[model samples]
Target: DAGVTQSPTHLIKTRGQQVTLRCSPKSGHDTVSWYQQALGQGPQFIFQYYEEEERQRGNFPDRFSGHQFPNYSSELNVNALLLGDSALYLCASSLEQGGGYTFGSGTRLTVV
Candidate 1:
């Protein structure tokens, strides 16, 4: 019954550096999705994983990649980060049929 959880609630990264963020899906869920939300903007989907493989992806640069493990936890990695990467990274989880998604508070990444 545990909800999704993300680490380091806040992150600070420099331009051109790479960063990796982690997420743990809700109990009994097998799918995980990542989204990026800029200030005042709705979340933009990055990718979704099911069965430990990526099932759907959005229009984002190759720099954005992710992985889902057997435990249903996930990790998002962004390489050559840009100032534009500064945003909130949210992780959501749902069942196979993909009902309403449950999102974490998100890790606020600030690129300076």
Candidate 2:
């Protein structure tokens, strides 16, 4: 009955620092995907986790990583943050069938 939930609705960080964002997926879901959206760009796939394993990854650098738990929750980690890393981090969840998905509003990360 619950939808995807993301934490630290807004965050501020300095370059060279690492930040971790969290997410709780919707019920009856077993997969979680992470995305990063710049000010004027579409969301870029960060990575996806299913059954606690990373199934797919986007063009992001190694600095971007994610994890999925048995409870269907997830987390996104970015290391050595850069000013350009600032963006909205979204968490999406759905069944492996991929019929549909639910996305959290996102955590706004601002790197200064």
Candidate 3:
């Protein structure tokens, strides 16, 4: 069985552009979390989805958004991107109740 999976392993975007990164949770996982990790910094929580609804969010601006599908997959969308948005976007999956998370290798997004 595969763990979490992410697409477009690498990407580059310009200021004001929009980007969407996708993730598929591991088997038996129904919750998904998104995080952003800048160089030399730990991952910062962006948001979490369960039952197709956003359950929690971090300190990111409104430009960050996400969605969970019935199949437990999720997508993170960022709009009006800025240079500060350049970072490794990570996707983690876990049980809704609570447990250790399985993380994808992450999608490296560079906002030029």
Which candidate number has the best lDDT? 3
Worst 10 residues of 1 by lDDT: 96-105
- In order, candidate lDDTs are 0.94, 0.92, 0.97
lDDT of 1 by residue, 17-89 (tens): 9999999998888899999999999999999999989999999999999999989999999999999999999
Candidate 2 vs candidate 3, lDDT winner? 3
Q: Worst 10-residue stretch by lDDT in candidate 2?
A: 64-73
Query: Which candidate's TM-score is highest?
Result: 3
Off by over 4 Å in 2: none
For residues 7-106, write the lDDT of model 2, one tens digit per residue.
9899999999999999998888889999999999999988999999999999999988888777878989999999999999999998987768899999
Better of 1 and 3 by lDDT: 3
Error of 2 at 31 (Å): 0.4
Please provide TM-scores, in order, for all candidate models, with all chains considered together: 0.96, 0.96, 0.98
* Residue-level error in angstroms, candidate 1, position 64: 0.2
Worst 10 residues of 3 by lDDT: 94-103
Q: What is the model-wide C-alpha lDDT for candidate 3?
A: 0.97
- By lDDT, rank the candidates, best first: 3, 1, 2
**Candidate 1 residue runs with Cα over 4 Å from true position:** none
